[model samples]
Target chain A: MSSVHFDQVYKRYENGHEAMRHVTFQVNRGEFVFITGHSGAGKSTLLKLIMLMERPTRGQIFVDGKNLKSIGSRAMPYFRRSIGVVFQDHQLIPDRTVFDNIALPLIISGYPDKDIGRRVRAALDKVGLLKKENYYPIALSGGEQQRVGIARAVINKPTLLLADEPTGNLDPELSNEIMELFMRFNRAGVTVLIASHDRSLVQALNYRTLQLEHGSLIEEEVVA
Target chain B: MKMASPLDEKAAPSPLPTERHKSFGRGVRNMDVVWRDKINAYLRAHRYELVRSLRTLLSAPFSSVITILVIAIAIFLPIALVIIVNNIQLLGGNWDGRPKMTVYLQLDASENAILTAKQTVLALPGVESVNYIPADQALEEFKRHSGFVDILYELDENPLPAVLVVVPDKIGLSNDGSKVLLRQIETLAIVDSVQYDLGWVHRLNSFMALANRFIVVVTLLFSVGAILVVGNTVRLGIENRRREIIVGKLVGATHSFVRRPFLYLGVWYGLGGGLVAWLMAELGLFALSGPMVELAALYQANFQLQGFGLINSALMLVCSGLLGWLGAWLTVAHHLDEIEPL
Candidate 1:
């Protein structure tokens, strides 16, 4: 069964700007896929559609075997809990410590207090920032902040992980390290989908790739 | 990039918990455990949010104190008014609920005439009892209580007339019974005139009824003012945490989850205000109690100022807390929906 399925999805904004046009694709369960295009190529729009942050003008989206169209606003939060999303801006609360930032998802999910500490520590360890858990986001370096975002996104062990330009602000070395983190999580049986325009980085890690141009799915590369 | 493999046996445990129930009895038992865990988690979440909101309020002591003080002043006015009205009612109650009529005998009324008048008053309907004051006893009693003992005795003759105090029964005082009794007493030949002070009592009672309504009006107006104060404060709070709210929503937080802390903040403000209002009221009553006792003593009456008892104090706190909750709810319901991740 496919983890994400999009059939002839079309998205047009209120001002008549077309964001996604007749986009059709499927990412199978446990698949590691990349969606790459230039800026304004509907990369973010496609990801938003899957997250139900924006509804498609004409299409049906099914995430984890449930039709998103049938899910009302009241059910949106529960639906989002099964999927993890990372932003380019990191979106960390400045007043909170790294530990609190990552433990947010667990708290929202109402995880037991005893389990929260253990899970947060394990997530921080996975991102190699266990010692800096007490530091606020303002004190962290750019790359360190991005890793905190990744840790927070995966803290709940979501079945599907989505990252939008996760390394947009990092140097090439740090970008490669971030990419490696995604690869490790993908190998751990969690499906990973990254929307990035970093061509060389995408080429170095050969895997299934979906290329969008002019809001349409123009090319799809399948890995043997 | 060199790190331990996720598949290594020593790696951190996966976040997911595997399921194991297969038999019917085991499933039911596991369901019970799950329910217990859920309840615990729910309680823990509320406890954490409550503490966190308190910390947030303390972080900005100046603004919070100002907000709470505004609410307290709003609460204090009505409470003070109520106390004033209550004391007035108590002072008036000293006069008694039913009106009394005084029948004045002629200055030269003979002992036989005075006695006949007293007996006639007793025969009238609604005349509960009658006490006759002879002219000689009246003169002496007046000299003792008039505070002009020497001057009252210097008068050429006793100008004061003998008096009969008429108290009406409960049934006679109802409706026009007292009026009829007054007219009958005035018809006696030996009685010079009859005086009924029910007019003064009626005026006092109407004033009390008017003041009672004023308390309700003042309470309602101040309550709205207090609610708006809290609502505006919470509105600013929402603005300050706009980014946090967006991030929380992005991470799968429900609207209620985002709203919890703000609601608690409002409650804290209300409770603090209520506490301050109670203190202000108690202190005002305390400061006034000294003078009040002295004043009541001057009139030879025993009266004590009443303060809000335990039940009323608790009610004030609970009421203010609910007001705070309501204010936060209105602000959050309006503003939180306007905010969404772009």
Candidate 2:
């Protein structure tokens, strides 16, 4: 079954701006997919729609086989608990330490304290930052901050992971490292969908790519 | 195509650890164990949120203290007013200011004639009781109270006259009947003069009633002001944590979860304000007790200052906390919706 399926979805803002137009796509469970587009090519809008942050103006979208239209605002949190999201700026709360940042999702999910500590440590180990649990986000380097963001997203062990320009601020080397980290999670039976404007990076990884232009899905490419 | 919502499907995989644990042995699971875990997790979440919110307030101690003081002062005004009005009413109640007429008699009147006059006054309509004061006893009491012993001794004759203190019935005090009684006493052959001042008692009763109404209005106005004070402070708190709220929402935090800390802040502010206001009012009352006793002594009235009783104090603290909770709930409900992850 498809983890995320968008069928002829359209998103138009209040001021006559259409962010997504007839965007139809599907990402099966355990698949790694990349959304490629220019800055205003509806990349972020697609991710927002999937996260239920914004509703489509037309057509139905499905996540984990449940139609998006059926989910109300009250049910948004419950739905989102099944999915993970990472942002370009790494959205780590400045006041919280790295461990606290990752443990937030678990805390929100009502995990036992002992379980939270053990899972947070495991996530930290998975991100190769186990020793920096006490460090605040401000003390981390750009790449390390992004890694912490990834750790937080995956800590809940969501079936689907969404990232919007996750490597947008990093150098090429750091960006590739972040991509490899996504590949590892994708291999672990978690479906990964990342949106990035980097053409060379998409070409190097050669995953299933969905290209968006003028708020429309123009092409789908699978290299290798 | 029709599709089933994963939420209702038993076949769907549960992402939350708690759900997954419950699904492990869905039919065979021990209900008691599940309930215990649920309660423990619930308690842990509350304990964690409580500490988290308290730290947020303590992180800015100066601002928190200032906000609390503003709330305290706002609530203190009405509380102090209520206490003052209460004391005034207590004094009035104790005085029981029924109408009374003091009749001074001629010094040369015979003792038998004075007794006959007292019996006549007691028999008059609406006259409750009449007590006679002999000339020698009156002179001795005057010397003791007037602080003029030498002057009294220098006079060759005792100039003070015998007196009769007459108390009127409640019905007579309520209307003009008492004045007619006074006039009747004035015409007595043995009486020199009759004095009665019922107007002052009437004025004081009316004034006390007005004070009670005034306190009710003032207390209501100040309670609203206190709630708003807490509301605005919580609103500002929500603004400062706007980014955190947005991030929390993005990560699947429920509205109540995001609202928990701000609500706690409001309760803390209200409770702190209540405690400080209570202290301020009690201390002020304490300081005034000495002066109040002296003032009561001047009037020759025995009275003691009454405080906001134990129940009243407890009621105030609970009310302040609830107001804080209500303010925070309102602010959080309004502001949390405005902040969306998008």
Candidate 3:
């Protein structure tokens, strides 16, 4: 059973540049998938389309069976709460502490205070930074900051998780560690899709990978 | 397992892949619990949002004070005028002119009869006092006021008649006591006629009424100006927090969520202004109270300065809150659309 569906998706910027052309794919429920391509290969654009950050210019997207076109602006928040996103820059609110950053999604979704505290601590525990709850993002290393972003994304227990080059600024070992964290979530039945152009990190995972070139999907490969 | 084409799937994913079905008996109760919990959680979030907004306002003490002081001074101008006008009306009532009867005596009348008449007039019921003005003094007063001293000096004898001005102890309940007194004084044997000009009295009354109307109109205009002042302040506040609003929108916050903080900031401004206006009005009245009482005593009038009544005070507070909310809403409606999560 698929969790996300993109059919012949195309994205064109206001300046007439088409970031995505005839792109199509699916991430089944409980499936772990990687989207790998060179810079400007439409990887981030695809993740954005899935997150509803950017609407498709000429295509349909179905997340959890609801067509993206049908979701109005007023209902977008409720829809977004069901899917978590982790950005490459670890776009955490700078002034907020680690605990507050992880608790933001749940707060937006209106979780109770006790429930928020429990869930936030649990998420921090998962990211292996339970003791850093009181610390701000600025005080953490790049890898630790990305971990907070990942923890925030999964804090809501969303059905689908999407990350856009989440480890782009991290070292090789830290990149693998972040990939390991994503696999741990995927193994627990959360659908995961990661967009990255890092060649080496994509190799050891042996997950189903979709490769894009320019603005089109050039190949789909699965390790034997 | 061999890999399949990524685009092979033609159907949309199922929204509920792991569905849980239960008996119908628990449906209503389950729904009740779900709705109650949902409402409770949202209420909790609103609590946090409100506190967060308040903290933001308090964090920037200098700018917040400047905004609030601007609003306060705007509100103070109109309120102070309103209170002053109200007290003046009270003083006007106390100084209102009473009807007076002027009795003209025959030129050839006896001095004894005139003296008896003066005594008789003073003894009359509801007659406060009687002043006997001989013809010579009356001529001098007329000459002084008529601005025609040359023509008045040409008179051989004092042509102005001797007059007795009668002040009533109190005006009648029906306001016709002065007229009845006039009729009684006219029957006096030595009196030639009784003269009382009511035109000047009516003019005085209308003047007071017109002054009140003008003050009320001015107060209303200033009130509207206060609203615009608050609106502009809130607009500037929104501009400063533009980035915070964009970030809030990006994180799946609704328009109201993004606007909540600004609305709170505006309320703080309004409340601060209202309180200052109230205090300024009270202090102004206090400063003037001693002098006002002394001035009213000169005319034997019991006058007191009155601040806003409960109803007026409540209206002022309610109006301030609404003005703030309206200003915030108008600004947010226009600016919120320009910012998008993208």
- Candidate 3 residue lDDT tens string, B1-342: 112132211111111212212222368887566556556665675688678867877888888777667777777777776776676666555534676667899988778899999998887776888999988899987875554677777878887788998777665212577667777788889999887645456666687678678767866676566666667776776777665565555556655566666676667667777887878777888898899889866654567889988899888877777766666666666676776756
Model 1, range A1-224, lDDT digits (tens) per residue?
Answer: 99999999999999998989998889988999999999999999998888778999998998877778987776677667668999989999999999999999888877876788999999999999999999999999999999999999999888999999998989999999999999899989899999999988888889899999989999999867
Candidates 1 and 2, the one with greater DockQ: 1
Give the true-contact fraction for every prediction, in order: 0.51, 0.52, 0.30
Could you list the CA RMSD of all candidates, in the order they appear?
7.0, 5.8, 10.7
Identify the runs in model 3 with alpha carbons over 4 angstroms from their true place.
B1-26, B94-243
Per-residue lDDT over A1-224 for candidate 2, one digit per residue giving the tens place of the 0 to 100 score:
99899999999999999989998989999999999999999999999999998999998899878898988876677678778898888989898899999998888777877888999999999989999999999999999999999999998898999999999989999998899899999999999999999999998888999999989999999777
Q: Worst ten-residue run, lDDT, model 3 chain B?
A: B8-17
- In model 1 chain B, where is the ten-residue run with the lowest total lDDT? B4-13
Docking class of 3: acceptable
Residues B1-342 of candidate 2: C-alpha lDDT, one tens digit per residue: 122232222212234533645555756556555555556665666678789888988999999999899889877988898898888778666645665677899879999999999999999988889989899989998886554777899999889899998888875575778768878888999989877757777788788778878878887887788788889999998888887888888888866678778878889989999999999999998999999989877755567899999999999999888888878878888788898866
Off by over 4 Å in 1: B1-28, B104-181
Clashes of each: 0, 0, 0
Rank order (by DockQ, best first): 1, 2, 3
**Better structure of 1 and 2 per lDDT:** 1
Q: For every candidate, how close is chain A to the native chain A in TM-score?
A: 0.98, 0.98, 0.98
| Best-fitting candidate, scored by lDDT | 1
Error of 3 at B283 (Å): 1.7
